[model samples]
Target: MLFFVALLVDGILAGSVYALVALAFVVVYRVSRVINFSLGEWVTFAARLVGTGTHALALPLAGALAFASAGMAALALAFNHVVLHRLIGHPPISLVMVTIGFGAVLQASTVLFFPAGSGAISLPVPSEPIEIGGLFLVPGKLVAAAIAGLGVLIVARVYRTRTGLALRAIADDPQAAMASGIDIDRHVVLTWSMAGVIAVVAGTLSAAVWGGGLSLVLVGLKVFPIVVVGGMDSVAGTVVGALLIGVLESEAAGYLNPVLGAGFSSLAPYLVLLGVLLVRPYGLFGTPGIERI
Candidate 1:
């Protein structure tokens, strides 16, 4: 019982990280229908910038975060506006492959520029752990969770407001939305900006939780499962899926390793994803089509 409780706590923390990343994935997809395989590279780029700014250049932590996020945000906006917008009606598969290629380029560029392979660097965020009833909790993880929750609320509320309602109208029908005098380019840019900020937030919180580096990109990758388990469009589903994967993976590593071996522990989420795909197809909260033939 104690073990399960501990697992739940740890899972919630880890799941917060996953939720943030999943949120990033969903944001871009919701607005532009881009999968953005390059998101991991964006995370790696932000981590490298943060480490360099704070450690190498002797900048203050707040300044470093601002610089890193700004750099990533600009790059994301450029990538979306210049490169992707040109391919607006291209085959989805082609766009996805292009993003994957772009990610490789960014990763290679980071290796050349930083010369420090994906080594871990301490985050500027506070890292002291808090204890409750013998369970140790990292404050950084809780902070990340709060930020993710706040982001969802803000976005939802914005959608409820006049401007947000306008965006939704665009989402519902881009042609009509444009004909209705909505600035389509501005909307697309806003979507990219939102996605970029979300990605950086995930990278920063992850740097605090697991340390900063290229390996932190895996935080984004692990979130792919969360998006799969939850519907890509469902923010609540992402949060719940993140928590479930976090606790289950941690518990497996802690207890099942003795019997199932260590190598299999990390694959738990993928297994869950495969099972979910087989059973639910669209995920826990994904849409069910009402086809009329």
Candidate 2:
């Protein structure tokens, strides 16, 4: 029972990171109306920047992460202004395809620039275990959760900004917002870059636990079920989904893995995704406006 509780706690903390990324997805999709499939590449690019900054260029870790996020945000702005700007009214497929191409560009650049990528690395923080009663906690996971929580708060604050209000209007109807004198290009470019910050945090957390490598890009796949399970358009729903998925995944890996074997642990989230979609196609908190993942 105690072990089960520990697994639950760990999963919830880990899910906080996924929730952060999911919030990014919600933010981007709500305004842009295009699901950027190249999300993984974005994450890898940010992680590579951090890895290169710290290990290769001898910069401090926090500074490296901050610089990486800032650089990525700039890159996102460039992407929106330079590429997506022209395709503003293009079909969704065209926009998605462009994003895919852009992702490929990002991945290729990471390989070319880094050559030898950052290998497995943990954060430069104390790894001491903290015990509360009989429960023990990992400092790394605690820090990750705190960062995720802070990110959620930041996202909430964004929704109440004047810019956010304009963005919301644009999200409701781009054509109408444009007719009403909203600067669609300016707002989108600004908002799109925010995703870069989220991606950096997600990428960095993954690096601290899993390693900073090209494979870190694939971890983006892990976030899919999260946004899907929670409504992709709902920030609050994403948090609930992340926690639900996180705890279930932890339980499956902790207990079921021993009996059902290794692969099942990794498959648990997708399995839940399938189950949820079968029942709620729009997701737990999603509206019926958009249908399709």
| Residue lDDT tens for model 2, 110-196 | 888875657444676788889987998888888878988899889888888998888888877888999999998788777788888
Q: What value of lDDT does candidate 2 attain over all alpha carbons?
A: 0.82
The candidate scoring highest on TM-score is 2
Clashing residue pairs in all predictions, respectively, total 0, 0
Candidate 1 wrong stretches, greater than 4 Å: 115-128, 289-293
Per-model lDDT: 0.76, 0.82
Clashes of 1: 0
Q: What local lDDT score does residue 68 receive in model 1, on the 0 to 100 scale?
A: 76
Residue 99 local lDDT, model 1: 90
Clashing pairs in 2: none
Among these predictions, the greatest lDDT belongs to: 2
